[model samples]
Target: MRDWWRDLTDLVLPAECGGCGRPRTVLCARCRAALGGTGPCRVRPAPEPAGLPPVHAAARYADEVRATLLAHKERGALALSGPLGEALSGAVRAGLATVRAPGAGGGSVLLVPVPSARRAVRARGHDPVRRIAYAAAGELRRAGVPAHVLPALRQRRDVADQSELDARQRLANLAGALTVAPGCGRLLSAGRVVLVDDLMTTGASLAEAARAVRARSWADSPVRGAGSSISGPASVYGGETRERRGEQRNGPAQQWAGRRSGRPPVTAGADSADGVVDGMCAAVVAASPDAFEISRN
Candidate 1:
């Protein structure tokens, strides 16, 4: 009801540019360009966390981009999701270009949003990442990249507020805090999976998300579940898993039929019998400028 009312009010109320505060416009032409950035580029945080997937970001989180994200995420500017989604789509496409194998086509792309805490959703009256993900999916479809928003990951424990935490601390706070909800692991095999989020700072959130997906894939594997491999816990980044490298392989999870924050909130996969997670790349609307620098360096 709160989300419905907010959506209704957004249509009727006079609006201002989310990035620039220009009256009567949800977003201005200039700000939209800023939001999209110079085209998506790979970004990596300094001291990138272990298990973190390769990530692409549309824009640097600064100036108009920062203001626009805060306006939509914190201030309920629901209309801004459209522009944000478009920006995210570009990043997703960039990620696909880098990770996808040649001639690997046909399956729809899955935009698995990083789940928000229930408390945050109640406080904000909506799930911002999921909403933007839906919009991003629509944009991808229109552009001929069959896509769907899949909400499969969830937080298993409370986490400290990330505003004050640096990279290492943020990582420790989120480690082992997320898991793939039951039954969704099967769907992860249905297509290419790209983690989506609004922003990336330390990369801890994405790393943790990658970890959870890898863990779930192992559990879903009939061979692994049967303890057939018996080597060790599946490594998400190890060469053993095709999903980690963006290739899909048939595995226990696939036999049944599937495929598959923020802080600056750490809000922020597929399978084979070996429990290889599919497409371990991530896309975000923005990332800390320093992360982009780290990528270049």
Candidate 2:
């Protein structure tokens, strides 16, 4: 097979860095540092989309970072997944730190990936986002940080190609396009959910994924003998939010709007109950450099 031969030859052939033409290395030191060397930072898209979850990213998607992501995602550079995954794990950890204090023992963090449409998956020959997520989970576990990948979110319907859409049109196209597989609520309740992606441009996709996860009811869903009732969730994010029966709850769209992280607080005593916040938390490996600029709106 063509694919089989390429894999076999790569093992014996001299390799080149995916990001740069550095010889004899899958990724060079310079390129590696470009991935996430300065630690993860919060990134907000210019003219942020509605319903977008607050997200952190490891590095700016430019130069080496941009090339590395494309190589792994589009070129079948499977060897690059390790470094890419490390970048994503840092973003995930930074996002988690926002909701939980450092050194606080708590529920596991679920790494839920946004699923590609079936048609896209077939054309690519691999699911790049999910693959990176799996590697990221492994990186977290190795460092004693509890995490796992769950492809719980999927396309509930087809969507128009996002390439030609503007920010507003992209948001409209992805609205209501995703849903969680039935019976996964119990698993979601066991820990926090952090949506992971390789890259986030307009953030329309992430917002829709969050809606599908939080819009459905979990109390009535069965998971063996385990179940929980956390009241009416107006907004559940990386941290705790409280709501009671008949009370209006602001969703993630409103809740994440006002917060910016200099030093994120881990909200442990914020709630004693064990449950995933109805709102969502999100992170990505890399984002456009301009995304970090704080807007005054």
On residues 177-218, what C-alpha lDDT tens digit does candidate 2 reach at each position? 887788776566556678888888877777667655654433
C-alpha RMSD (angstroms) for model 2: 8.3
The number of clashing residue pairs in each candidate reads 15, 4
Residue pairs clashing in model 2 are 100-266, 101-266, 234-249, 236-279
Mark the regions of model 1 whose C-alpha exceeds 4 Å error after superposition. Answer: 101-106, 224-278
Root-mean-square deviation per candidate? 9.3, 8.3
Q: Please give the range of 10 consecutive residues that has the lowest summed lDDT in model 1.
A: 259-268
Which candidate comes out best when scored by TM-score? Answer: 1
lDDT of 2: 0.68
Q: In model 2, which regions exceed 4 Å deviation?
A: 1-12, 100-105, 217-279, 295-297
